[model samples]
Target: MTHILLVDDEPHIIGLLERALRADGLEPVSAEDGESALQLLDERDIALVVLDVGLPGIDGFDVLRRIRAGGSTVPVIMLTARSGTADTVEALDAGASDYVPKPFVVAELLARIRSRLRESAGASTVLTYDGVTLDMLARRATVEGHDIDLSAREFALAEQFLRHPGEVLTRETLLKQVWELDFDPGSNVVDVYVRYLRGKVGASRIATVRGEGYRWEA
Candidate 1:
């Protein structure tokens, strides 16, 4: 079972998260504050950390910095009441894997946690298919000895396709996995971006299935 470490100040919040994580078949260990969270870091098997930013004793960011300074690459998802862009950027700069604003929906939080943990799994995610390669770690893609630069959204879309190479990806699945939301099929955004990606990754790398969606080629 994936082990998740949850740190928050509110007892109710901890209880809620624990229940949700447990229901998902994950073992959740929690801390009431940053100090205790830092202490719990001594455990080596924690796969991911969901940390609340406004804790007493050591602040979340402070604890995060200490965690990174010790060279721990454990993925952290920061939960903060501050929804400002600066706050998000600051947490990302401090080595947070992702950020979720408080008053979060349980479903959205679960999705975010899943994505962060996959990214933290690093070595296991170097997806490859046919002659193309995607190194999620280096945020780089290559095909037939050529390197390509992909926009963040494009890269995420490509990542999805790579994971299911040779399989048709329904529009809804692509939208949910890449944008985390449903978008109108009439919207050209996905098509336009896929065109851009195909141009770089190889003209025939991604194939359109008419009204269905797309598929990664063999």
Candidate 2:
């Protein structure tokens, strides 16, 4: 599982962010102060960092500096209340991948996180699961060496399932990531796309998790 380091002193914010990250298939490790945040960076193989600038100690800029100086290229997103131009410039200069201000919309923040991850995922243009393959760069799908035709949305849905095989992905998560819809549209779009993907991949390739959502068979 990919781990995300969340550094914030606010308990409420931490709790909220943790749940949000988990729902998106990320494991979040929390630290309330800058020292612990730095410690976590050393202790865990974190895929990314969502850091607060107003930390109790060491501060986020210092932590970001240390991370970059230590030769760690791990992506960092500064999450802070400060929206000043100088503050944003400093965070970016110190090696932050992105910055999100407080009172942020959860969907927007998630979108930024996904965008940063995509930028960092260099040259990863293909995804395969159980002989089903998705060519991300080419926008193509294939099953067992046979080419399969899929719509744009169908390909995105299949790519998500292939990336996280065996993990039960909620309809909400699918809708958010694949369609960029933060709330359910009161429609069966996810199920409809899943059926389209299964037709091209195979019927048994994806498992419906009853009321939960769907899971790509491992």
Instruction: Tell me the whole-model lDDT of each prediction, alpha carbons only.
Output: 0.81, 0.83
Output the TM-score of candidate 2: 0.56
Q: 7, model 1: CA deviation in Å?
A: 4.4
Question: Which lDDT tens digits does candidate 1 get at residues 1-218?
Answer: 89899999999999999999998888999998887887888854789999999999888999898887675768888899887767875776576777788899998998888877776665455778877787765667888758877765777788888878889987878766665445676767677878888888877878899989899886
Q: Report the CA-based lDDT of candidate 1 relative to the real structure.
A: 0.81
- Provide the lDDT at 29 for model 1: 95
- TM-score per prediction, in order, is 0.59, 0.56
In TM-score terms, candidate 1 sits at 0.59
| Model 2 pairs in collision | none
Off by over 4 Å in 2: 123-218
lDDT of 2 at 96: 73
Clashing pairs in model 1, backbone N/Cα/C closer than 3 A? none
- Give the candidate number with the greatest TM-score: 1
